[model samples]
Each structure stands twice: as C-alpha cells, then as structure tokens.
Target: MKEKTIDYVLRATWMAVSKMYNEEAGKAGSTMATGFALLSIDPEKGTPSTSLGPKMGMEATSLSRILRTMEDKGIIVRKRNPEDGRSVLINLTNFGLEMRNFSKGVVLRFDEAVKENVSEEDLRTFIEVAHTIMELINNKKIYKPETSAK
Candidate 1:
C-alpha cells in the first residue's frame, strides 16, 4: 500500500473490520449490526427506542429492520417507557442478554488482540487521529456547504 491516501486507509481498514465482525457474528447466527445493537442496549435498564439508532450510529430505517429481526428472533421486546408514556423502551430478552455477553467477549477479544499487537503510543495516536477525523467531518470542514453557495 504505497502512498495510500488517508481516506483509502480509513475505508480499507473499516471494511476489513466490518468483514471480520460479520464473519464472527455469523458463527452465532447474527450479523455485525445485530451484535452492535445488542451491545448498545443496557441489560437491566433498557434503552430508549429512539436513542438506539443514534447510539448505534445508524439511520432509523436501518435500525428499524434490525430491531424487527431481533424482535422476531426473540432477542428484544419493546416496552412502554415508564417515565414517558409517549416513548418506547427497547428491552433485551434473556436470550438477548446472553447474546450481549457474547458480543462483549468478541469486542474485548478484538481489543486485546489490538493491544497486544499495537504499542500504547501507537494506539493513542490512532485514537487521536480518529477523533480529529470525526471532528472535521462533524464540523463540515471537508465539504463546506456554506462556502459552496458562492
């Protein structure tokens, strides 16, 4: 990978990671998205249905499909929010809790492997760079719509 652009590196790495996660999740009859959603929900307290999408960094349509699948699989159930009758809470079923534990283990194992291979300083720098990239994107620095109006 000589002279790879930062975008290329980012996309390539993420694609690889996504593939790896999907493969691992497949062994348990799941997808990476399902695993991620499972990990996002609180085991005991549950999470707001609306918040699940943002928490998982996905859009409503995408999250809706995953939630539907999870519901069909008996992994999750929607309950009325005790605090807000207008809102719904996404509660994990007993099976969901077990799946969440599996997801946690998978993520921890990935983290452990990375830590074992990458030096502390390198990992810190990686995180720093990632944050900076996210900040730039969030701030619309790369594609300034305001400036483009001219």
Candidate 2:
C-alpha cells in the first residue's frame, strides 16, 4: 500500500478538526471563526483591530466580516483606541466572555481527549515535527530549490 504524503495527512487532519469545531460552534449559535475571534481578544484590555487579523492568521476582509457578525450578535464592541487615534480596539461583551469561556472549555476537552489517547512521547514528537514544518515554511526553505543550483 502506498503511504500518504505528509502534507495530505496534515491537511486532512486540519479539515476534520475544523469541521468538528464548526459543528460545536454551530450548536452554540456561533461559528468557528467567531469562537476563534473571541479567544483571540484580550478579555480585559481588548485587542487592536489591526493586530487581530495577523494574530489569527486571517485576512482583514474575513476578520472584518466576523467582527461585524459578532457585533450584530452583541458579542463584541469596537472602540476607538485611546493610545492610537487611527486604530480601533475589539472588546468582548459579557455574553462574548461567556462564549469565550465555552470555547476554551471545548478546546481543553479536545486536548485532554487527545492526551488520554496518545502517548506523551508520541505527542511530543508530533509537536516537534509540526514546529519543524512551520519553521521550514517561515524560513522559505521549502520553496528555495531554484536557488539551490546557483
């Protein structure tokens, strides 16, 4: 039997995880994006609008849409930053905080389940491999073959 490529395994795993999170979020009257945004924002100080997109690995347009939906749902509020006149801050409402806690619990439960099923050594290796893959992409090592022959 042919073995699956690493990328394929990674993508498939991510898709399955995302679908699970989305389903859970849907049951809570939210989306995965909303739950992620809620988790990303600082509960006390709020998060800067510009910083959230990069922090979430999301584009501004997509984050904007999510924020709008959150605001409409009374989950978040946008306030002008006192320290930076040109920037806006995203703050969670009381309901948003509740949802954030729920999101956190969901994440923790999933993590605990994985830990219970997977050995610690295997989990550590998986984390190391994931970090190495991320580092390769971040360092532009994956697509630098054109420069290799020079």
Per-candidate local distance difference test? 0.95, 0.95
Tens digit per residue, CA lDDT, model 1, 120-145: 99999999999999999999988987
Worst window of 10 by summed lDDT in candidate 1: 141-150
Q: Model 1: how far is 94 from its true place, Å?
A: 0.7
For every model in order, what is the number of clashing pairs?
A: 0, 0
TM-score of 1: 0.95
Give candidate 2 misplaced runs (Cα > 4 Å).
145-150
lDDT of 2 by residue, 34-101 (tens): 99999999999999999999999999999999999999999999999999999999999999999999
Question: Over 4 Å off in model 1, which ranges?
Answer: 147-150
Give all candidate RMSDs, comma-separated: 1.6, 2.2
Distance from true location, Cα of 49 in model 1, Å: 0.5
